[model samples]
Target: MDGEYEIKKAYASILESDFERAIEWFERAVRLDPDNAAYHYKLSVTYARSNKLGKAIEHARTAANLHPDNESYSYHAGTLEAKQLLQDAEKYIDGHTQPHLAVDLLKQALLLDPLLIEAYLLLAVAYGELEEFGPALQAAKDAVKLDPQHVEANRLFEQYREKLKRYLRS
Candidate 1:
């Protein structure tokens, strides 16, 4: 009964656009029903809407773990993790000091979301910088396959094609 009341308050707070209150109520509901994956997922969504990504990821992960068969929960957790990995990869790229680190991070991101075109594009660029032409070209090709009209992917694909041609000729 208490859990139901908390869920009702949480829903009402969401309708009112009071995300902070919604989170508070949702947190209470989750505590009252720790095994309730739905409660955890709802808390995760509220945290996401509030732009508290860390908390969102945590709760989303909890929900997904509790209900591994729930595709929606798992998908949300994967997406959140991928986004965080992408951000870390960008930081490594910006530093210009660890292309390998960025590549590793981006690889993890792509593993989580294979169709992430941006991750493929960035991965291709990173591989090119490392002179791993085969994988680089493949990644570029993958990006183009995922989104043919993606301007940067197309550019990268052409660039790699030229690079391979020159290498073979030499």
Candidate 2:
């Protein structure tokens, strides 16, 4: 309604898995406390959960900017940005898929969370699809370093490693 009650309602709605209602209440809370970084942060997470990447990234970046020391906000925003870029990369046209943007986005994601093993794996895939074997191998290596036991990452590493050797020899 006004302040704390609205926040409580937002949290309750979130716990109940009523994301639409959570968004409504969170928006009201933000309106009531426009400068509250916590409110903005909560709104960002809620938006991400609802698959609204643009809004989620906007609010998460705002919260991170409002409190630069908060690594969580920056990390969350970067993860969302990477996800959006990966989606963009996965899109198709007639008979082709474009994953060029994924390189930059995945780099940005790693900057925010260097330990993001999935980002490395995805970057490897994107680079491989683009026929950039060297970069793809490097990305796969990075993923393996982060998570040596990760099934997909390990597979990518082996695949790219062999590809690189073939490319070098040929």
Candidate 3:
């Protein structure tokens, strides 16, 4: 079948919320026209909807590289990369096994998506876990700077600030 026909099938599958079929059809389209940035972008979106973030990021990066002038494609690729990093950070943070690793991941995520308020919040928690109260307070403050009205960020900022003050006194 032609790549265009495969793309159409993928779109129909997506409209029906059959992400598995959409992914299959999009994969076929990508295989048939490997250089087609549009096909890669569509496949990336389908994979993302299916919660296959690794696959989504792979295709998104390909699409962005193939069509560098498409700001949307580049933006999507960066966003997906940031989300993947954030998710990885959350895994470490949730397990409470490696705050240092989590901090590194959160910093990378924030570099890619500076507006990710959650990354800052998580960074604060990771720093606090390491007994780095000053950095924790700064991370919390960064979160608050991003969204001054965020109740949790504001609360965390106050908590970290107090911790830092006590650490300084001691």
The top-ranked prediction according to lDDT is: 3
Candidate 3 residue lDDT tens string, 1-170:
45999998988988898889999999999999999999999999888988899999999999999999999999899888988999999989899999999999998988888988989999999999999998999999999998999998999899999988898898
What tens-digit string does per-residue lDDT give for candidate 1 at 80-128?
7887788788887777778899899999998898877888988888888
Residue pair clashes in candidate 1: none
lDDT (Cα, 0-100) at 63 in candidate 2? 89
Would you list the rank order by lDDT, best first? 3, 1, 2
For model 2, which pairs clash?
Answer: none
Q: Pick the candidate with the highest TM-score.
A: 3
Give candidate 1 misplaced runs (Cα > 4 Å): 12-21
Those runs of model 3 whose alpha carbons end farther than 4 Å from true positions after fitting are none
Candidate 2, residue 142: Cα displacement in angstroms equals 1.4
Please provide TM-scores, in order, for all candidate models, with all chains considered together.
Answer: 0.82, 0.82, 0.88
Off by over 4 Å in 2: 92-99
Cα misplacement distance, residue 133 of candidate 1 (Å): 2.7
Better of 2 and 3 by lDDT: 3
- Whole-model lDDT values for every prediction: 0.89, 0.82, 0.92
**Which pairs clash inside model 3?**
none
